[model samples]
Target chain A: MRFALDLIESFRMAIDAIRANKARGALTTLGIIIGIVAVVLTLTAANGLRDTFRQSFSAVGSDVIYVSQMPWIMMDDFFNYRNRPPIDLKQARELESKLQGRAIVNPYLGERRDAKYRSEIMEGVQIIGTTEKQLHMSSAVPATGRFLQPFDVTYKKQVCVIGSEIREALFGSANPLNQMVKLGRTEFRVIGVMEEQGGSFFGDGPNFDRQITIPISSFVKAYGGRHGRLNVDLAVKAPSSESMEMVEYMVIGEMRNIRKLRPTEDDDFAINKLDTLIDTFNNMMGVVLLVGLLVTSISLFVGGVGVMNIMFVSVTERTREIGLRKAVGARRSSILFQFLFESAFICLLGGLIGILLSAALTAVINATLMPASVSVLILVIAVVVSLTVGVVAGFVPAYRGARLDPIEALRYE
Target chain B: MAVIPEIKETTLSLNAIDKTYDMGVEQVHALRGVSLDICRNEYIAIMGASGSGKSTLMNIIGCLDSPSAGAYYLEGENVAAMSENQLSEIRNRQIGFVFQTFNLIARASIFHNVELPMIYGGIPRGERRRYAEEAITRVGLNDRIKHKPNELSGGQRQRVAIARALVFNPSIILADEPTGNLDSRTGGEIMGILDELHAAGQTIILVTHEEEIAQHASRVIRLKDGEVESDLRVDDTDACIAPSESLHLVGGATS
Candidate 1:
């Protein structure tokens, strides 16, 4: 009970002292403010980047695996990966037959090309050449007309399905179905329009809404053969998400058999999944978060030093007052707590202002660039960090004040 | 020497107390085997020149400093062996101090300054306020309770300090040169409050260098060097004796 009363008295004294020196208190907290702002911004930006990655990778289908020439995140031995033979259309067909009953295998090719309709032209349009099975491997579905049919691939038909972005760019509100559009000098009729799927902020993954889909046979003839610059990448979807591992093993075993690779040799093809991309993204974000916090902590340490300096000055200026308090029955612990409370209160004030400023910055980021929001967890962390800084910084000066001899302090002019 | 009236139940006793200060090359003895007894409700004045160690004795009596040798007993409790925190508790509960400069925290209101001792005493806020108000009222500063010390006159500030010293109802009120900073008229008014407190049976030990201030106490103890030079009780008719003659008489009586 006595300790509680002492704490309350100390808190009141701290507040009184701060109010008496308002300008000094405010100036003392400036370092804390800048440090808090930097810390909060770094955490918020990491959150935004994570959110963007999650949204972008969602469209890639978690249960689907891709067979590509190279790993999505290559480390070393770049030439070894480059030397591997491309997985061509024949290999995709054989794999499809091998996994006919267990999974849906779709092979596709993509390249950036210019698309034109009437006088309107969209540059850097992602044109994807795939078979009818492509619809099963993607999250986007045609919102109007119909998707490509197997007959289109069998006859090498010139019909195409455009994404929402392409539809808006070339035809605007005009009916795009049955209209002919030129894609890289070849004309094809637009048979469908896919629904819009928003792109990721980081642009690290495919943007589904900005692509154009055409028959793979026509793509092979017009763009290039499998032996040309275009490589065939196969997408294999498991029967169920829970059975993904089982399907992956089966696909790998079948690919090894078809490629005639011995058990002693390493598989030349890379099996890419959403997990690999997500893992790589998380690792990169971890490094960024670590570096950001490390740099920001330096400023916070400097801020703490500033607080310590000011507290020492305050202690010296109030030496007589401290002596008076000691003479009037105040314990040494009471004096120590008084100064500690003052510094902590200042830092807490700075932390609150920093949070408000960062929240405003997050709003601006959301409005102009990416999706960002400050979470409750971040606010809690910011408050804890500031209080810790205050306590650490105030300790030395407060200790010195508490240890002062009452006689000498009273005599101090 | 007048009889001290059977010692009247000793409230404090010091046994050959010695205080020394380390001055690097040679040690300075502030008090050399000083011993005395103070009974309840005794208004005693300790007088000496600047280097005569009266301040050191006052500090020891107030529990602000411990003696380097010998024991100090307040109400028969050995204070010399107490821990620092224990001494702080003793000061908080048993001793009140009024400084010549008034020692009121300048930024605090009169009420807050008076309530400070009780706050450290850990009294509940409601009770603390009531006691502080009563003490302030006793000093006739009820209307100035909210005023800061800087806003008050020297006499008023001294009264506030007296109120602070009285709020705890300590066993003894230690006033060291209490009116040193005041003009004669204001100083008389401040001393008048101490006189009233003494009349009300409050034990007060006054330390002063001024002969006029020392005359207010019923018993006066004079110090020279680090030892007691004379101890005398004043009779009403002998209040105006010449300083040299009074000292000679008191010196003869003590010897």
Candidate 2:
């Protein structure tokens, strides 16, 4: 009970002292404000990026694994992966037959080309060549009309499915269905238009809504076997997400067997899961968060030093007052807590302001840039960090004040 | 040796208390084996020139500094051996101090300055306010309770300090040159408040270098060269010599 009362009294005294020197208090808190703002914005930006990545990545089916010639994240010995043989259409077909009835395999390849419908032309449009099973292995769905039929790949039909961006770019308000558009040199009719899917946070990943899909036979004829190199990536969808690992092992085994690699030799093809991309993304985000916090912490350290310096000055300036308080029966802990509370209160004020500023910035970001919002967890972290900084910064100066001799302090000029 | 008077309950007892200061190259003895006893409700003055150690003794009595050697007791507790926190508690609950400069926090209002001691004493807020108001009223500054020290006159500020000293109802009010900064007329008024508080059964210890201020106490103890030079009690019968003549005679004899 006594401690509670003392705490209340100390807090009141701290507030009084701060109010007496408003300019000094505000200036001392400025460093903390800048530090906290940087820290909170860094965290909030990372959070927004993660959220955006998750939303865009959902379009890539989680239960599907991609068989390619190289790992998504390369390690040392790039030559080892570079020397691996290309995964061709023949190998994709063989793997599909081996994994028949257990998984749906869709082999796809991509090329950047210009698409033109009459005089209106869209440059650098992604054109993906895949089979009818591509729809079953992805979250993509046609907004209107039907998807590619199985006979389209067998007969090398000149029909194609276009994304919403392509429809908007080439056809604009006109009916795009059955409209023939020239992809590179070949002309193909738009049989379907896929729904709009947003881009990734980094803007580096494929813009799903700006791509068109055609039959693999036609794609091989026009784009594949250029210099006898055909690198086909097989999208293998498991029966369930839980069985993805088991199907991955079977695909690896089938690929190794089809390639006729010795038991001692490593599989030439890389089995890439959605988890690989997510993990890589998480690792990259973790580093960004770490570096951001590390740099921001330096500013916080400088802010803490500023607080300590000002507290020492405050202690010296209030030496006589301290002496008077001690004479009036203030315990050392009371004096210590008084100063500690003062600094903590200042930092907390700074932290609250920083959070408000970050919230405002997040609004601006959401309105003009990517998705960003300040979470309750970040606010809690910011508050805790501010308090911790205050305590650490105020400890030495407060301890010196608490240890001051009342006689000498009272006599201080 | 002074003749014994009627017996009374002792409020403080110092037994050969010694205080020393280490000034780097040399050590200065501030108090040398000073023994004294103060009774409840007694108004005593300790007088000495600069470096005579009266301030040191007052600090010891107020529980601000511990003796380097020997024992001291407040009421019946062994104050010399108490911890820093315990001494602070003793100062908070049992002793009130009015400094030479009136040490009221310049930024605090008169009410807050008076209420400070009780706040440290852990009094409830409502009770603290009541006691603070009562003390402020006792000092005859009820209207100036909300005024800051800088806004008040020297005499009013001193009165505020006295009110702060009285709010705790401590065992003793230790005033160290309490009116040193005031003019004679204002000083007399401040001393008059202390006199009234003493009459109301508060034990007051006044430390001063001025003979006029020392004369207000019933008993005066003078220190010279870190030792007690004389301890004189005023005789009420000899009104003319009681205030000045007898005190000088004793001082002359002792020196």
Candidate 3:
């Protein structure tokens, strides 16, 4: 009960002290506010990116694995994999028949190109070249018309499925079904408008919403002349009954056999999964948050030093008051807590203001650009960090105040 | 000498108290082998020149500082062995101090200034408020409870300081030049309050260099060159207490 009263008294005194030196206190808190704001804004954006990433990757189907030329997170030198052979149309067809019951396989690839409808042009729209099975494998359902048919691939028909972003950019509000749009130099009839896939795994490049999908044969016919070697990515969807590990094991074995790898030779092809991308994304996010916090904390360190300097001045200015308190029976701990609480309260106030400001800014950004929201965990962490900074910064000065000799202090003019 | 009534309890005893200050190359002796005893309800004045260590003696008595070499007893407890925390508790519970400058917290209200000691003593809110108000009323500053020290006159500020000292009901009220900063008239007003407190059975040790201030106490001890030069008791209608009491003073100092 007495401890509680002491805390209450200390808090009251702290408030009074802060209020008395409003300008100095506010100036000291400014550094903390700027630091917290930077940290919060960066972390909030990172958090939003992580959330968007999970949603986008989950939409790509968690059970599906990709067979590509290079690993998503490259474990070794890239030059070593340059000699590996690419999986072509013939290999995809053979794998389809070989693994019919175990999985649904779809070979696909994409390149950035301009898509045009009349006068409207959408630049950097991903032109995906894939078979009919990608509609199920990629979990992209047609929002308007039908997806690509098997005939479209086998007969090399000029038919395409556009994403919502391409639909909006090229056709605006017009009915896009059967409307012809130019993918590179080839004009293809829009068979379907795919559902809105709003997020990109790699933040800026190749958003799913801005893609146009056509049959692999039509893609080869349209853009095959531009590149000498076109590597097709194979997407394999495993059965719900089999665990991903089991699926991965079977896929690895089949891939090695098809590539004619010796028992001693390492498998040349890389089978990448969504989890690999997710892990790499997480690692990148960690670095972003770490660098942001580290840089901002330098400002916070300056702020903490400011607090310490001001506290020393405060103690010196109130030497007589401290002496009087001591003479009247205040313990050393009481004096220590009083000053410590003052600095902590100042930092906490700055942190709260920073968070509130960042939250407002984040809301504006979410409305104007990307989707972002500050989480409760970040709020708690920000508060804890401010308090820790305050305590650490306030220690030496408060110790000096606590240890002031009453006789000498009282005698000080 | 007149007979001193030995009926009341002894509140303070300082035996062979010595204090030294190391000024780097030279050692300055503040108090050398000083001993004294004070009983309940005694209004004693300690008198000395500036370098005679009267402040140091007051500090020791109030448990603010320990004697360099001596056993100082307060209410039969050996105070020299007390820890800093214990000394703080002793200062809080047993000694009330009044400074020359009325050392009240300048930013706090008169009521809060008076309530401070009780707050340190961990007295509950209701009791502390009541005691604070009563002390303020006793010092006749009932209307200025909400006023800060700067908002009051010099005499009123001293009264607030006195009320703060009284609110804790300590064993001794140690006033070091309580009226030093005030004009004679205002100083008299403060002295009147002390007189009233002493009349109501409060033990007070007033430290001052002025003979007029020392004359107010029932007993006076004069120090010179770090040793007591004279110890005397005042009697009614006469300056000094009878010769037998004077002999006891000599006996007490020598023995």
For residues B1-255, write the lDDT of model 2, one tens digit per residue: 122345456777788889999999999999999888777778889999999999889989999999999888788899999999999999999998998898989878899899988888888989999999999999999999888899989999889999999898999999999999999999999999998998898999999999999888988888998998887776332112222343565567556
True-contact fraction per candidate equals 0.52, 0.73, 0.65
TM-score of 2: 0.93
Q: What is the per-residue lDDT of model 2 for residues A2-35, given as tens digits with 9 covering 90 to 100?
A: 6777788789888988998899989999999988
Q: Best-fitting candidate, measured by lDDT?
A: 2
Those runs of model 2 whose alpha carbons end farther than 4 Å from true positions after fitting are: A76-79, A200-204, B1-6, B236-255
Q: Write the per-residue lDDT of candidate 1 for residues A157-272, one digit (tens) a residue.
A: 99999988889889999999999999998999999999887775466457787889999989988788434766789999998899999999999999999899999999899999
In model 3, the Cα lDDT at residue A97 comes to: 78
Q: What is the per-residue lDDT of model 3 for residues A68-104, given as tens digits with 9 covering 90 to 100?
A: 8887778788888877888777777777777888788
How many steric overlaps does candidate 3 have? Answer: 5
Please report, as a residue range, the 10-residue window in candidate 3 chain B with the lowest summed lDDT. B235-244
**Which docking category, incorrect, acceptable, medium or high, applies to candidate 2?**
medium
Per-candidate DockQ values are 0.57, 0.65, 0.67
- Pairwise DockQ winner, candidates 1 and 2: 2
